[model samples]
Target chain A: MSERLNVSKTYKLYIGGAFPRSESGRSYTVNDAKGGFLANASRASRKDVRDAVVAARKAQPGWAARTPYNRGQILYRVAEMLQGRCGQFTDELRATGLSKSAATTEVEAAIDRWVWYAGWADKLAQVTGTANPVSGPFFNFSTPEPTGVVGIVAPDSPLLGLVSVLAPAIVTGNTTVLVASETAPLPAITLGEVLATSDLPGGVINILTGRRSELAPWLASHMDVNGLDLTGASGDLAVECEKAAAENLKRVLRPVEADQPTDWTAHPGITRMTTFLETKTVWHPVGV
Target chain B: MGDAVSVSTETLTGAAELRRFLHGLPGVDQVGAEERAARLATRSIKTSAKAYAIDLAISMVDLTTLEGADTPGKVRALCAKAAHPDPADASVPKVAAICVYSDLVAEAVRALEGTGVGVASVATAFPSGRAPLEAKLADTRRAVADGASEIDMVIDRGAFLSGDFQKVFEEIAAIKAECGEVHLKVILETGELVTYDNVRRASWLAMLAGADFIKTSTGKVSPAATLPVTLVMLEAVRDFRARTGRQVGVKPAGGIRTTKDAIKYLVLVNETAGPDWLSPEWFRLGASSVLNDLLMQRRKLTTGVYAGPDYFTLD
Candidate 1:
């Protein structure tokens, strides 16, 4: 028999729950490590980001309303799904520019990162909440609440960095509008597939693949988006998004260093998980 | 308090007359209306047009608070918001009106006393017209007496669906009588009507009975004020004007909660009803959340960036 034909996948942007082609109807060709043509990724437009924000805002209230234990279970499910699809992600990472060993390590680290944030989902409030020492006959307690919808810029390390950033935001019950890396988006999109199956509700994590410069500013200043993570953005791009985010006072996480790359395998702390959270304090009178 | 209604007597005499008049009106092609509304919805209104539309839509809003938990303070704040939607931006115009339940008309009037913004009240056993005719008229009379410049009255879906067309017609005419000079918006609650034919019939029925504006919903029912239904109402008004030479306005309330949704309705007016129905005098949106979106879009137009909801005042 003659050789069978390979049907390549049409990589589309993930917005809300569906994989829609960019509203702009544009795509960019992604090249493999040795400069071979991999596939065309959707060049997400500003409209796509706006739509993602709307979906994230819609899903946030319901997701945040869920019990913390359930949220943890959902996050763990995503990790389980990712671990099951480890070989596919490793191949995608290899195509993107990583060496074979590096690709496997990145995929494994990505799965571990999901598990890390999954545990934090149920522990975030207890570790961070505080009881205020008021002088009157009142009990004032302060605790963190999810800050509506978040916009995330997924970093260069497509698998690990993407998971590392997305896991923290959603673990705390905040829904996200994520812009995957411009050149390396396949792994992140594969993660989106894993998310779609892991009992995670649609719109909880809307992933878009495009040029960050074209898509980031809209999310940065989007009125409905409560927070923006620019951990993936560095140099002039980071500065531009930070400026735009000020228009709506979006809670932004700027890259710590101007040109430094975030080490995705490092042990991430409670910092990014709490970035998009608003601390609401409640006061109750002590009755006789 | 007396203004004559010039409805054609031949059509006003009986139920048979009203039914023939309503059914004789052109039937709405459900699929065609939905396709047209969807097409208009996709028309992109860009920067300059968006800014103009945001302000125009803001001016066309019937800023509403219809909850059971509503209070005087809430209505006052809503009225204040209607007068100045954005406290920081002075260039923005006030809203078209403050729509409240009849009980709070006085509070709305007191708050928006001299702002040139209108006060619209929902009466006639609103959200449902199950009350006795006299009680409903009393509700209308009380709202007008309390100083509502516009009255939004609900139709008894039971009466309409049960084919008692004259009862619905007479109820509207009676409320029109109590309205005095107040503009009357007849809510068809198209969600309950369920078909474009019924929505077309209800629009004609309301217009024939002297409704100054025909609204799509009471905002109390599900599937209220969909694009297709509103398009059918707009077509009815357009056709009515063509025949009677008297224009009526259209308001699509409920489920229209974004700047894009409001602009789509504007495009519906622009395309289906022409520019004559583009002003606050001719068109309205019965919504609350749409105002914030319009404000945010307006800010985006001015600053060349998108806006957050927290930057604007909440009512």
Candidate 2:
């Protein structure tokens, strides 16, 4: 029998739950860690960022309206889908210079991190909400609400870091437009496929794999985007993003430990979910 | 422009004559027309040209509120929006008209008395012209008496489909007679017409019956105002002018909610019907949400950043 030829996969941007090429019709070659050819990724333009923000905005209200328990189940389903594709993620991580064992560990940790964030979906209100004692004859209470669309720049830790930043924003019902790590974006695109089959609504999590520097400023300055996460940004880029984000008063999360790389395996606290949440306080007249 | 209307009553004397005149018109190549429209949509109007198109689109909007739950307060608010599209920016041009139901025309007229914005009422049992000829004429008469500058009448699709072209033509001519000085826009409700040939025939029929403008859809049907359908209508108006020397306007309402979609319609008009039909007098957009989108894009061009819906008033 003759040898069979391999059918290579094409990596495209995930916007509004469909995989479409960059509107600019631009693509760049992505090289593996060993300087060998890996694949071509869609080099998203400012228009793609704009489109992602629009999609995230359109999906925000409906996603936030879902019951917290329902949101939790959907997030948990994402972890299950990710687990089934563990081998592919491990292989992609290996191409990104991680050893076999290290790649396996990262994939497992990414799935586990997703599950942890899913657990927080239904219980976040209990921990963050409070009842206050007022001086007048009234009952006062404060509850957390999703802060609309969020723009995220995923760190280069590939699978684990991307999930660590993404799961928290969406588990709380806030839709996100994420710009994946430029050099290591294969894992993110693969993750988008997993999300597509996981029953998560379209436009809830738009993933664009492209140059972070070219795409970040557009997201920061977009007025419709309510919050921004600059985890992958450093130094001047981080400074630029903060300045542009100030134009719209976007709630921004600056990179933690800017001087050093983030340790993705460490415990990710509830701060990420809380950062993109707004507290709404209500006062009811007693015995009215 | 100097000649009187060439499509006289003699050309449309009876039902058989009207059918021969309409059926004798050229058949539309459905695939060719659709391909041309799709090709024109890819033209990129950027920078200064984009700014010009945005303002022009803003000026050509017929800000409409036709919901069954419409109130006087809602009509007044819509009228106010039509007059001052972007309250914060006076440089933004006012919309061409405010479209409402016939009963609310008086309220719209009172609110927009001196704002240079006209009041247009959808009449003739709008969205479905199933009512009698007397009732339809009464509907037109009431709107005109209420001070409406324009009357948008719906055609009897059932008559047009069943080879009763004279009935539809006579109804339009009668409503136009009632409109007198008011611009009479005839709605074909093309979504229910079912074919490109039907759209072309209906456009010619409306123009022959003294329609000041030929509008697509009532904004109440599925697939309202698509690019290909508008292309066919624009071509009909262009051809009608070539033959009769009378230029009519084209308005594509519904489903045009984005600046991109509106710009595509402008490009279609400019290309398919020449630049003469590019002005507000020659063209109008029958839409509500498209105005806000045009405003957001205008702000983005001047301010160098995107504008959000939170800043714009709710439609």
Q: Write down the lDDT that model 2 would get.
A: 0.93
Model 2 agreement with the true structure over B237-268: per-residue lDDT tens digits: 99888877899999999999999999999999
Clashing pairs in 2: none
Taking every candidate in turn, the Cα RMSD to the unseen true structure, in Å, is: 3.9, 2.6
The TM-score leader among the candidates is 2
lDDT of 1 by residue, B1-315 (tens): 011123453446878877766666566777888889999899989978888888899999999999999999999999989999998999999999999999999999999998999999999898888999999998999999999999999998999999999999888998998897899999999999978899988998898888999999988899988899988889888978876899999999999999889999999999999999999999999999999989888877887666667677777
**Candidate 2: docking tier:** medium
Model 1 bad stretches (over 4 Å): A1-3, A124-148, A246-251, A255-258, A274-288, B1-12
Q: Considering just chain B, what TM-score does every model have? A: 0.96, 0.97
Candidate 2: regions farther than 4 A off = A1-3, B1-11
